[model samples]
Target: MNATGAWDRLEPKLAATNARVAALESDPSRRNSFVAYTMERDSAYCDLDGERLLMMSGYSYLGLAGDERVVAAAKAAVDVYGTGNHGVRALAGTIPLHEELEAEVARFAGRERALVFGSGYAANVGTVGALVGQGDTVLIDKYDHASIVDGCRLSGATVTRFRHNDVDHLERRLKAAAPTGVRLVIVDSVYSMDGDIAPLPELREVCDRYDALLMVDEAHALGVIGKTGGGIEEHFDHKVRVDVKLGTLSKAIPSMGGWIAGSHDLIGHLRYAARPFLFSAALGPAQTGAALESLRILRREPERVTHTQTQAQRLRTRLNDAGISTMDSTTAVLPVIAGSDDAAYDYATACRKAGVIGLPVVTPAVPNDLARLRIAVTARHTAADIDFAAEAFLTAAAQTGLI
Candidate 1:
C-alpha cells in the first residue's frame, strides 16, 4: 500500500484512543487526575502549581533522594566521569564505578554476585527471558508488576498466574506443570499496590516441594524491610532460599537502574546472555555513586528503616481511627480505598486542596472496585507531618463524602 493509504487506515484508531484520553482529562471532576505535577523541590514536600503540598505518594522510603552525602557523591562522579557512558557495558561502557556498585549490591542482597541493568524493568525482563524460554514453565502472581508480565511474555515460556498471595493456588499450578522442563516461580516480595507482603517462607517450602526455582522481586522491599534494610530475607528473620533476587535502585536507593543478585555462575551467564544487559547503555556514573552512598547510609543508620515503618503504622492507625479504609497495608505503602475511579480522583483532589499530595490509582492499574489513593510514608515524614497528613486525609474524606 502507498504511504498515504497506510496513514489513512491507521489514523482513525489512533484518533479514537486520543479522544478517549482527552475525554478523561477534560472532565471537570477528573481534571488533573492522572497528570504529573512538577516538583519544585525534593519529594518530601513539593510545590505543585504554585502550592506547596506534603508528598504522600512518593517511593523514596528512606529519604535518601535529597541527602547531602548522596548528592555530593553523585556530583563528584559527574565531575570525574562527565555525563554519559557512551556505549553498552559489554563494549566500552563498563567502568570501575559499575564494578564497585555491583559488589556492594551483591553484599547488600546477601548473594554471591550481582548484575546491574539500565533500569528495574530491564532487569526483570532480561533476567526472566535469559533464564527461561520455550518448554519451561513460569508461574507468577496475578498482581505482579507489568515488567514481570512482559518478561514472561517475551521469554516464550508457558506462563501461568496463581491467585494473588494464595499459596494453595500456587501449589496447584506447580503440580500441574510438566516435570521435565525448568519450573520457575516469581513473585514480588512486597506487592506495590496492595502494600501486603508475600509469604516468602511458605513460598520457599512450596518451591522446594515442587523442585522449582524461586525468584523474588524486592523493588519495594529493599531499604524498607529487614533489620538493616536487607529486604525480604531480613524481614522474615530467616534466610529464605530465594534463588534469584531482583531489585531497583530508584526507590530506597534514590538512584537509577536495577539489579539481579545470585550465584556467580548465574550472574556470569546473564552478563553475556541477557539482551538488555548486553545491548543497553550502562547506568550513569552519578547514579552508581549515589546508590553506593545511599546503601552505605542505610547500613550505618538502620533507624531510618524502623522510623519509616513506625510512621506507616501511625498513618494507618490514624486512617483506621478516622474510619477510612486502608486495605491490607502493612508496609510503608498505604492504599485508602475510594470505591470507584471518579471517587478516587475526587479524594486525591480533595487531599491536594488540603495540602497533601496523594495520587489516585484507578482501574486498569487496579480492579474497578479497588480504586484508591496510594499513599506512601517515608522516614522523612515527621510525627507532626504524619499527624497533619492524617488530619488532611480525614478532612478530605469528609469533604468528598468518602468517610
Candidate 2:
C-alpha cells in the first residue's frame, strides 16, 4: 500500500483508541485511571495531584527501593562506572558489576549460572525464542504474566495454555502432546494478579513424567514467599526440579534488569544465542550494584520476608472480616474483587480519597467479572500501616458498594 492508503487504514484505529480513552477519562470514577503520580519520596508512597497517598499497589516487596545502603551502593557505582555502558553486552558493555550481579543471582537462585537481560520482558522473550522454534512447543499457565505469553508467541512455537494452577488440566494437555520435541512448561511461582502460588510440586511431577522442561517465573515470589527469601523451592521446603528459573531485579531486588538462571550449559547457550541479551545495552552499573546490595540485605534479614507475609495475612483477615473477598491470596499481594470494571475503578478512587493507593485491575487484564483492586504489601509497611490500609479499603468498599 502507498503512504496515503496506509494512513487511511491507521487513522481510524487511532481515532477509535482516542475516543475510547476520552470516554474513560470523562467518567468521574475513572478519572484516576492511569493518571501519572509523582513519588515524593519512595515506592511506599507517592504524590497524586498534590495529595500524598500511602502506596499499596507497587511490586517492591522487600522495601529496598529507598534503603540507605542500597542507595549508597548505587551512588558508588555511578561514581566509579559513570552513568551508562556505551555498547551492547556481547561486545563492550559487560562490566565487573554485571558479572558480580549475575554470580550473586545464580548463587541466590541455587543455579550453576545466570544471564542478565535489559528488562524482564526482554529476558522472557529472548529465553523463550532461544529455547524453542517452529517445531517446538510451549505450555503456559493461563494466568501467567503477559511477558510470558508474549515470549511464547515470539518463539514461533505451538503455544498451549492450561487453566491457572490446575495440574490435572495441564497433565491432560501434556498427555495429548506426549513425546514432543522440546516441550516446555511455563508458570509463575506466584500469580501476580491473584497473589496465589502455583502448584509447583504437582506441575513438576507432571513435567517429569512427560520429560518436559519446567520454567518458573519468580518475579513476585523471590522475596515474599520463602523462608530465606529463596522463592518457591524454599517455600515448599524442597527443590522442585525447575529447569529454568526466571526473575526480575526491579521487584524484590529494587533494580532494573532480569535474569535467567539454570545449569551452566543453559546459561552458556543463552549467552550466545539470546538476541535481546546480545543486542541490548547492558544493565546499568547503579542497578547492578543496588541489586547486589539488596540481595545481601535479603539474605541477612530474612525476617523482612516474614514481616511482609504476616502483614499481608493480617490485611487479608481484616478485609475478609469486613465481608470483602480476597480471592485465594496467601502472599504479599492481595486482590479485592469488585465484580465489574466500573466498581473496581470506583473502589480504587475511594481508597485514594481515604488516603491509600490501590490500583484497579480490570478486563481484559482479568476476566470481566473479576475486576479488582490490586494491593501489594511491603516489608516497610508496619502493623499500623496495614490496619490503616485495611480500614481505608473497607471504607471504600462500603462507599462503592463493592463488599
Candidate 3:
C-alpha cells in the first residue's frame, strides 16, 4: 500500500501549471481568464487597478449586479439572519428564506417544487449523481458544463457523450446503448462558450422516442432569451417538455447558488438523496435574498432581455460585416473568433487598449483552433457602447489579422 512512487509523479503535473504561469507572467498583455475588475456605477465598464475598461466578459446578462434593490435585499437578510444559519439543510440550516426562495424559483421555472444548493456546481453534481447510478446510463452533450461532466463521472453510471447539439448523434448513442435502469439525457439549453441555443424541440422528440428523461441546464439561457426571459420552455413557447430544469443563481440572477425545479416527486427525492444539498450548509441568507429579488426584478422588467438581445445582434452584425466570425451565436453571449491562442490573446489586449474588455477564451473551454473572445452583453449597454465595442473589435481584429 506504499504511495511514495505515486506522490513523486504528482510534481510533474504541478510543474506543468507552473510553466504556464511563468509564460503568462512573462507577457503582461496576455490574459488567462482570471482578471479582476471592480464594477461600480456602470455595467458597461469596470475598473482594473484604476484603469477603466469597457466590460464584455461578464456574465451579468441582465445588468442587475449593482441594483440598489438587490443590494438592499441582501443587507436586510444579513440584519435578520445574522450572516448565516446554524447548520446544514437536513438540520437547523433550513431557514425560512431558503423555503421562500425555493418556492419563488419553482414558480418562476414553471415546476411544482424546487431545491437549492450552495452553488451551481453542487446542484448539478448532487442531482445527477443522486438520480442515476449503477445500471443507469447518462448521455450528455459533449460540450456540457464541467460540473455536469464531473457529475456523470461520479455517478457510477455508464456515461456516453454524443456530438455537441447533434440530435441524430444522440439518438444513435441511445439506440446503441443497453436497455437499462435509467436513461438520462442532459444538455445545456444555451451553450456558454458557443453562445448558441440548443435544439430543445428536436432533443425532446428524440428523448421521447427512446423513452429517456431529458434534463436541460438553463445556466446561460435565462435572462438572455425568450419573450419574458422565462428560459428554454418559454423560448420554445412551452411546447417541449424538459423533465428536469436546473440553473445557476449566479449568472444573470446576480446571486450565488444553484437550483433544480421539477415535479414534487422529483424535488422530494433530491431533498433526501442529494448529498451536497443534505450535507452541505444551506445557501446563505444574503445570497437567497438577493437571488429572490433579482428574479422578481427580471420578471417585472422583460424589456431588459429585449434590449440585451438587440444590442448583441447589432454587435454581431457589425462583427460579421467586418469579416469577423461570431460563430452561430444568437444570444447575449457572443464569441468573437480569433484563429489561434496567441491571436486571441492579442485580440483581447488590443481590444482592452481600444477600451473594450472582451477577454480571450482559450483551449479546453473551446477548441484550440476556435479560441475566441467570450463577450457578454447586458441590458445596460447603450447604442453608443455597442458601436464603440464593435469598432474596437473590428479594429483589433484588423490590427492583429485575427480574422
TM-score of each: 0.96, 0.96, 0.97
Q: Could you give candidate 2's per-residue lDDT for residues 293-355 as a string of tens digits?
A: 999899899999998999999999999988988888999989999887777777888998899
Instruction: Supply the global lDDT for candidate 3.
Output: 0.89
Which digits, one per residue and each the tens of the lDDT, describe model 3 over residues 186-270?
9998999989998999999999999999998999998888998889899999998799999899999999999999999999999
Q: Write the per-residue lDDT of candidate 1 for residues 102-184, one digit (tens) a residue.
A: 99999998889999999999999999999999999999999999999999999999999999999999999999998878999
Write down the TM-score for model 2: 0.96
Pick the TM-score winner: 3
- The 10-residue segment of model 3 with minimum total lDDT is 24-33
How much RMSD separates candidate 3 from the native structure? Answer: 1.9
Compare candidates 1 and 3 on lDDT and give the better one. Answer: 1
State which candidate, 2 or 3, has the greater lDDT. Answer: 3
Name the 10 consecutive residues with the lowest summed lDDT in model 1. 34-43
Candidate 2 wrongly placed segments (more than 4 Å)? 27-29, 40-43
Models ranked on lDDT: 1, 3, 2
